[model samples]
Target: MAYKSLLTLASSAEGVAAAVDAAARVALASDAHLDALALGVDRSQIGYSYVGSGAVILQIAMERAEEEARLNGKALKDALAAQGPDLRFSLDSAVAQLGALTDLVSSRARYADLVVLPKPYGKGSGPEAEAVIEAAMFEGQAPVLVVPERGFAAGAAPRRVVLAWNQSREALVAARRALPFLKAAEQVVITIVDPPAHGPERSDPGGMLCQLLVRHGVKAEVAVLARTLPRISDVLARQCQDLDADLLVMGAYGHSRFREAILGGATRNMLESAQVPLFLAH
Candidate 1:
């Protein structure tokens, strides 16, 4: 399905430009309505985390944080204007406690066809960024697209795309969610990292998936790679560059909520180091 409504989460002040750029890029490509959300923490409610117990210190910190949030909102509007002219877009802001940002983003994302988030930075990233990522993936019940720190100017639309295919429920879900992009892409490579040892072996690893997409007017070719590298994610990342792929679509893997909040070997690795934009769903 095509993304008729796109929502982008700007977790921090520094991420506004990247978020706007990504949202606008997709909206322009698919003629979708774009909604950019800038999340702000109520400094008074969250001051204790930054400042000690003193009331006066907390008040000062809260004031500074609030002011910064205001400036961030203004900057986001300016960026949107500069980048998304002639595109249908809206700017919104939300203020909540640091602990509740995830729920807010997830709830808002429910009405959206796709949720775009800035990639988590190495440092200086608040909990809101991480929470938004987790909520969008697990709670939004929608496709989550993570734009790298470099920003999403990959192409007009994801012309060269790679779908990481495995015979798992998660993979199927991811593929279905990314159908619009696959159908629109000039080239689609269904890359299967490694085949399973057991189960009835199919003549082609990614053949069934290719056929499925072909039924929907997507011409996808299969590419199989042996698990010779130390990390499958690393190999996948390299393959993206090798193929000059602009987007990488894959399923997110996480176990039970009690065991691990977000735990997936390849998912984690790609989340941390993927240079290309990623379209993921759980």
Candidate 2:
């Protein structure tokens, strides 16, 4: 189905423009309604219990929270006015305290067709971005598009899309969630790395997926690449660069989150290396 509703989160200076641009680009391409949420972190919520704090301190804490929200809201609005003036959109702000941010973003994301996250997930990202991404992917059950933190390529569009294939449940879910994009894209390639020679995928790793997508008019081609690099994410990123892909569609956290985190899994690796807009589902 075509994406009719989209949500985006922006909080910091580095991520605000990129997040908004990604959302706006998709909304324009799909003629969708866009909702931009400007997020401001309220550190007091996570820092102090307030059991020993005086009334004056509590008041100051609340005031600080409100001020952060207000500032982020204004920044989001300015970006929207400057970039998305002709698009159908609404701007809102949230005072995101640590513990409560998950519930807030999840609830908002529940109604969106796709949620646009600002930065690529990995090291050096803020806690607020991580929380919002978890809420959207796990709790909200929505496909998320993580855009570049700086901006998109000058003339690139999502028309050239690549889907990483592994025949896992997570892969299937990600592909299903990204169907709308595949159907609309001018070119779609299903890239598969080394395959098991003894399994059902012995002869063709991504052929079955291509067959299914063909029925849906996706018209995807299969690209089976040998893993020359130690990291699969490196291979995928190199493939995208080779193909000049505008978007990379792949599954997130195929294994347990803890295992992935500890082992430096594909999801984590890709999050750190993706050069294009990355679309994922858990």
Candidate 3:
């Protein structure tokens, strides 16, 4: 579980500085070589409303978008420097249509142990960013550390870690992948909310996970609580705050992704309102 290489996505779009900052800080903390990628999006796909305007206006709008995109790359580089020390890392940029850009990012991400992505990994972070996440996880077959837009502070390594456990394939994958962090953490908590009473977990919820961690030499505490709130993520957030957890490791989209997209499941809710760094794997 020791990460030797890390890839961070710095989109040449607006609102990506915080993710770069967090990635730089994380790169500085972990014993891993860092790859910083500056992704540029096609302006044509950005604003379709420009189609209704005259040719002159459309040309002007495209030029303006290109200029802003250029500025976005500069800002991302500045963000890496603003990490308070000269970061020793390699920087690269990719400029292509949305379809190609995702493939490009995924190709680069294949060499890295973890892909660092921006949180709210939905429409708000832009379509390109969303594509990057899906590509890295699903296509590249790598885990993603979803950083918040607010960014993590310097020295953001996990001291206290929280594992959102449920007896599902996705959850099991996340837990096993997160063993490194759990072993390094001073405190680890296996938090389960509203366990299903009719399954094998009817006897002991989260106990098997805690025991599995023990086999890996990681001592963890377990907490099984009711869904006091509407969303499971809300309950996990409260637990993270109480435990002062710096990192949260959990599975992403155990159910149908389309269902979660429409009905708003734990993965979507957590992505939208993440309070700390979330490590996710499919």
Alpha-carbon local distance difference test for all models: 0.78, 0.80, 0.75
Question: What's the lDDT of the predicted structure labeled candidate 2?
Answer: 0.80
The candidate 3 region of ten consecutive residues with least summed lDDT is: 43-52
Give me the displacement of residue 119 in model 3, in angstroms.
2.0
C-alpha TM-scores of all predictions = 0.87, 0.90, 0.84
User: Residue 25 of model 3: what lDDT?
Assistant: 62
For candidate 3, the per-residue lDDT at 184 reads 72
The TM-score, computed over Cα atoms with residue i paired to residue i, of candidate 1 is 0.87
After superposition, the stretches of candidate 1 with alpha carbons farther than 4 Å from their true spots are 42-65, 200-202, 254-264
Q: Provide the global lDDT of candidate 1 against the true structure.
A: 0.78
* Tens digits of per-residue lDDT for model 3, 174-207: 8887776778777788888899989788898888
Looking at model 2, residue 256 earns an lDDT score of 75
Number of backbone collisions per candidate, in order?
0, 0, 0
Q: After superposition, how far is residue 156 of candidate 3 from its true place, in Å?
A: 4.5
Off by over 4 Å in 2: 45-51, 54-61, 120-124, 153-157
The residue-by-residue lDDT of candidate 2 on 1-282, one tens digit each, is 888899987656556677777777778878899998877766564345556665666577668767777876876787777764668998888775677888888999989999987674544456677678878988999889888765654432477888999889888999999998888778899998887778788887888899999899996999989999998899899989999888899998888767876788888777766668889898
